[model samples]
Target: MAIVREKGAMRQWSRSQRQCGQRIALVPTMGFLHQGHLSLVAEARLRADKVVVSIYVNPGQFAPGEDLDVYPRDFDSDVEKLKPLGVDIIFNPHDLYVRESPEKNRESGHETWIRVENLERPLCGGSRPLFFRGVATVVSKLLNIVEPDVVVFGKKDYQQWRVLARMVRDLDFGVEVIGCPLVREADGLAMSSRNVRLTATERKNALAIFHSLKRAEELVRSGETDSSVLIEQAVTAISNAGGKVDYASIVDQETLKSVDKITKPSVFAITAWFGSVRLLDNVELSNN
Candidate 1:
């Protein structure tokens, strides 16, 4: 696959595709090749004539003290993985975030930011206040730069998927955003790049995140609808397994507001810190 890094070249190549009437699909990622990422590419293969996967660990999306420096990187390995997947192009931009103004901040010199209000107030956003601002801004940059016909995101990052969907609608980007299913490991833990950082024992304990979500699902399916009860059980499960709970919540899938019962399709999502690694997982609750 050809690696397009410079903005000028990327725009030129994408424009050529548009002129040739080629349908482009993009899988935007912070590099550290995983099955979950490849799953999105598989779907993109079916959806478009050309698949462009951009592998740039966005600095804008990271919080001030987060693991931006040591997150993960294996560009060569990532390229090897994508070659077999029929990925036509890999847009590895050195810097997707350009300075809009001269005002410099901790993360960037640009003061311009894209904020998705309401959706950013809960879940991951509640903790990482500037996250979706970083996320929305970079995604808006990529969507504008790549100008792909479609972009694929994993449902594992359920809130992120929803946030970007709302951003696309609100901004009228005209690119189809597709949410693929959450991919998992054999042991039931959601596959994440950070999984490599876990100690063997911590990895075992990390399974509790998934287990707790399942337990909450069971609680909802069995006639328990109280949000407090669900949160209590989830927190207890993760804590017993040695992982500290950041947040365990059940909320309306679309609105993301906490719900009292499974009156509508909802999401059971959790974020926890296992050792130095923070992990997140979610399960769906739908009426029968």
Candidate 2:
């Protein structure tokens, strides 16, 4: 597979593929590939004639004091993992946003940002205020650079998928945003790059997050539809698991607004801290 490092090169590659009448699907990723990521790549492979996976650890998405400095990264290993997956090109841009000034906490020439407004104000958005702004801006850059027929995102980041999907529609990006099912380990922990940072004990405790969501799913299936009751149970589970709860709420899967009752399609999402690692996972709920 070809590795593309420059935005101009990527756009040229895209133009050539389009000229050849080849449909392309772009899978955006922050390296340190796991089965969850591969699953998205696999889906992309099936959807288009060519697939481009962009490996970027966006600094814009990380807030002050967040884990941007030490987020897990092994470019060589990530490349190896994708080699067997039939990826046509790996768009590893060196830097998309460049700051003219090098002063700390000083404004750079980069002043533009994209926001989904109401969609980014709940769940993970509530805690990490700057998270979605960074995500939206960088993803907008990727969509512009790659210009693929479709882009794939894992629903594991439920809020993120919704935010970007909405952004595409509102901004008229013209690329199909596909949300793949959230992948999980055999024991049910949502696969994440940060899973490597968890200590043995913390990893075992992390199962509580998924388990609680599963139990909540069971309750919803058994005629429990109250959002308050479900959210309370998720919070208590994380607390008892020795993990700190970031946010747990059942929101409409599309609008992302919290529902008073689970009368329609909704998602029970959770973000919790296991030791220093913050992990996200969610389960979709539907009464029908």
Candidate 3:
């Protein structure tokens, strides 16, 4: 795979692809490549003639006191993983690519931000205030820069995926957004780049998030309709596993508003802090 680092070079490369009538697919990531990321790349390969992956550890997306400096990154290994996936270009740009506004450009200013209302205020949204804004802004920039026919996101980041879908539809980006299933570990924990930071004991405890979501699903399937009970069971499971619970609730899948009755399909989203690392997971509970 050819690594395109400079913006001018990447734009030139993408222009050449467009000139040749090749449909392009873009996969935006924050480096620390894993199976989940590779899975997206593989999917992109199938849908578009040319696939471009961007590995920028976005600083804006990270909140204050978050792991911005030590988030985990290995560029050589990431490149090695993408080599066999037939990735046409790896757009590994510096901070300037996405944070090129006058404020960010100035030596003493902060990064430019982006936010979508209603959707960015609940679930994981409450904990990380600036998170979605950073996400939305970077994603918008990537879409504009790559100008791909399709962009792929992993469903593991369900809220982010949903928010981006809404952003694209509302803004008319004219690119298809595809959500891939959550790839998991043998022990059933959803695969995540942050999983690298987990200790042996913490890793075992992390499985509780998945288990809790499963139990919530079982309760929903067994004709239990009380949203509070399902959320309680999930919280109990995660706390029992020694993880500090953040928020566990069932909300409308599309609107993301908390629901008292499971009258329609909803999502059981959970977030918790395991040591210094924060992890999140969700399960879709459909009454249809």
Candidate 4:
């Protein structure tokens, strides 16, 4: 894969590709890739003539005390994993928003931010207030930089995927936002880059998050539709397995509001903490 670190050069390559009439597929990531991330790359390969995956750890989404400092970075290893996939380009830009003076950001008024508004009020946003704005902004930057015909985001980050999809629509980004299905480990823990930080026991306990979601799916299949009842069951299961529940909610997949009954298809989503690591997972349910 040809690695382009600067945004201008990346855009030039994208322009050249467009001139040649090659469709570009982009998979944006924060490096330290895993099988789940690679799955997105594989999906992109099937969807477009040229695949471009970006590996930049965005600072905008991180909070003051979050795991931003140690978020994980192995660019060399990440490239090795992408090599076999026949990826065409890697846009590893250092900064999407460059400040003339580093010290000015602390004192200067924030100039720009992209907010999905109501879509971010629940789930991850409840605790991480600045999360979506950073995500929307950085993703908007990437969408502009790569200017791909299609962009792929994993469904594991259901909220992020939805936020970016909405951003693309509202802003008329002219790029297709494709949400791929979530992948998991054999024990059901949704694969994550942070899974490496989980101690042996914590890793095992982490399975509770997925199992609890699975239980909710089983309940739905068995004709249970009350959202509160499902949330209670999920909370109990995760607690028993040693996870602290952040939120166990069943919401309308589109609106993201808690639904009283599963009259139509819905999403059962949860976020729990095992030690300092926060994990999220969700399952989709529909009558059909």
**Best candidate according to lDDT:** 2
Which digits, one per residue and each the tens of the lDDT, describe model 3 over residues 1-288? 798888777878888899999999999999889998999999999999999999999887888888998899999999999999999999988644434466564655555566788899998888888899989998988888788999999989889998999999999998999999889888888888899999988999999999988888888889988999998888888898889988987899899999998999898888898877789888888865
Q: Rate the local accuracy (lDDT) of all candidates.
A: 0.90, 0.94, 0.88, 0.90
lDDT for model 3: 0.88
**TM-score, cand. 3 vs. native:** 0.94
* Alpha-carbon TM-score of each model against the true structure: 0.95, 0.96, 0.94, 0.96
Model 2 agreement with the true structure over 1-288: per-residue lDDT tens digits: 999999999999999999999999999999999999999999999999999999999999998899999899999999999999999999999968875765655566688999889998999888898899999999999999999999999999999999999999999998999999999999999999999999999999999999999998899889998989988988998999899998888889898888989999999999999999999999999988
- What does the lDDT read for residue 162 in candidate 4? 87
Clashing pairs in 3: none
After best superposition, candidate 2 residue 39: deviation in angstroms?
A: 0.4
Residues 10-117, model 4: lDDT tens digits: 999999999999999999999999999999999999999999999999989999999999898999999999999989998899756775586665546446999899
- Which stretches of model 1 miss by more than 4 angstroms? 99-108
Evaluate model 2: give its TM-score: 0.96
Between candidates 3 and 4, name the one with more favorable TM-score: 4
Model 4 poorest ten-residue lDDT run? 102-111
Clashing pairs in 1: none
